[model samples]
Target: MSICKWIAAGTLAVVLSSGTALAQGNLDKLSSFQTTGVTEFTYVEQGGAKAEAIRKTLAGINLPDGFSIDLYAIVPDARHMAVGPQGIVTFVGTRKTEVWSVTDRDKDRAADEVKNFAPSLAKAIPNGPCFSKDGFLYIAEQNRVLVFPAAEFFYESPDVAAFNVIPQGELVPPEEESYNHTARVCKLGPDGKLYISLGQPFNVAPAEKLDKYKKWGIGGIIRVNTDGSDREVYTYGVRNSVGHDFDPETGDLWFTDNQVDGMGDDIPPGELNHQTAMGQHFGHPWFGGGDTRTNEYAGEDVPVEVVMPAVATEAHAADLGMHFYTGKMFPAKYKNAIFSAQHGSWNRTDPIGARVMVTFIDAEGNATMEPFADGWIDENGEYLGRPVDVTQLRDGSILVSDDLAGAIYRISYSAQ
Candidate 1:
């Protein structure tokens, strides 16, 4: 059968099995040139006993001098966020089935509303949200890609038009799906293509699975047109890169790769990689984390040239979402620097991470990673909040999403 027929049949099977009527015909309305509804805003109350408790916790967060952190909104399982063109609304996604719409409708710089975005749609792990300059909102799901037209305008109601960019089961084979590394992230590259990361489901993929993973682009980043055609692998030899972004200056791709585990805590280091050209392989199973080879691939000959990381972070740091600071709210030294979230370590004897990191890129394309905002891990090794993704709002403040706290925090700089 043709690919089109196969896709159609697979889509039907998925719809029938999932008991969801998200058919192509229904979503196709997203492509139409119609604006059908009046935009409405919902205001969320920010004061309560629970709010006071959260605010008290925020006091423990430490940042640079002249910086303060404030509670932005109470969003459950907030993962990644995409701010709209005019900064009127911020669309957030999660590792679960819901995408949230957050708005500061009164322009108070504090969110006045936070609610599910298009709650009518049956979404699965809609963890990645990217927006085009022209009001097109693309969400990368675990097994699908969806585009919402004029998401900011029609987000208040459930009638917002959404079209599938990559149909279900096309991102990765359904059989290979696993709970590990299934939280996909996406970004609209400067070249106008949508880039999605597909993390291979393994701590260190075995040699037997290397070829299959490469063939499926399972351990790499894939790119395609805005319409979801011409799909191709952009990079490979990565274990599980949950976060990546294009450099604003050179348009090069830089990503954070979670290193391999069970290597005595400190043997293999987490990676911050710079991809200057396409198809460049970063050492993965062969070199396990940074340069330490895994037992599974020991003594095996590496076929391709491995690209060394720009910076090697501590092992098990679990670096996730990242963004380059381009907002004017911060000092000049912070402009164009990278801010990433270290989701904290789980397997290490002494937990390390659960904070935000800053990487300054030099003129020669080198990176130096350092702790930016910490205090998430207390002296007793307890977690206050685990930072997931870092993004900048229109007014130059930085927003950090914490899944553990189920809230988003805004970091603003004010000189004393």
Candidate 2:
């Protein structure tokens, strides 16, 4: 298509609306966005009634015989986490505006401080924070991408160096912004690019939005250069993926996607997808999840060759965040396995999946998933905690964030 035709096809918004983001060849002011250096940061109390209550819920959590779980920090609306490359601080993002800086200053496994990072800047749904191998931290907000150079080292101060990779109102066309399915997740790919997921706004995306979604990478994953240039859609047909990680050994991209809702109890399963090559499509409007066809486009011919999921989990369990286990603290059987969290169900008749899952991969690259932790739900079906994201610490132990409980939990294993 000619450049004129591309603009005429409703994508003029890509140029007209995204001024500083797409129009500029380079970031408007790279490494210049900084805060006011306000020292009065609001800190989450390490010891309090709330902390004890969240700790008490640990008794109901069941892990492997030699594994144990404990409260690591107190955070509000913790969604996804990024452990700093230097292993000093762990940056946790939330669906709300703040990105938390968590530190265990005493090296005691439990966090000694929980405070907001970059207090002077305004952030919208900064749900994904990832770090480069060297030190820079990149945060994926709802409609913006910001980078903080040496964030782990500078987080002790209220003001940290920041830059706009993709400026606000530019990650997606501003008009497509919605509350649902907007929490993005990002990772620095093996190719040295930043990969970010852009979710379509609706429960089941409408056909009218398909063209624009394809053009702007809505409902798909898009990757860009570290400076936010050379942006393009990397994967297609994803509904909404809040969790993704690269295979430690293979460098393949694996992600967990939430399937279409309002389908009956068990019609369409949740998805754990593996993308071996670029431009692969996972099923969306045509097939809800697995082989289940969606009601909206049942009779229509599917547009793209859809890549089936590596694992299909239970329906309505809401698979959210995941991590590829490469830690040495666990047994050899778990070396390259996948550890993921299910945030549990909302509209199901009998609630299920408020637990952590372990997926083991074989020599043939096949996957088998089983529950690694459970019992976050009560007998009356009330959720005591909802696990959002999983990440490993420098010590090789893993941390799980619970948004419902507003706390981070540390899980480790020790042979007795």
lDDT of each: 0.84, 0.86
Residue 13 CA error for candidate 2 (Å)?
A: 45
Report residue 411 deviation for candidate 1 (angstroms): 0.5
TM for every model, in the order presented, reads: 0.90, 0.92
TM-score of candidate 2 on Cα atoms, chains taken together: 0.92
Inter-residue clash pairs, candidate 2: none
What's every prediction's RMSD, in angstroms? Answer: 7.6, 9.8
**Model 1 residue 131 lDDT?**
91
lDDT of 1 at 272: 89
Off by over 4 Å in 2: 1-37
Clashing pairs in 1: 44-112, 344-354
Candidate 1 lDDT, 255-349, residue by residue in tens: 99998889887868898899999999998878888778888788889878999999999999889999999999899999999999999998899
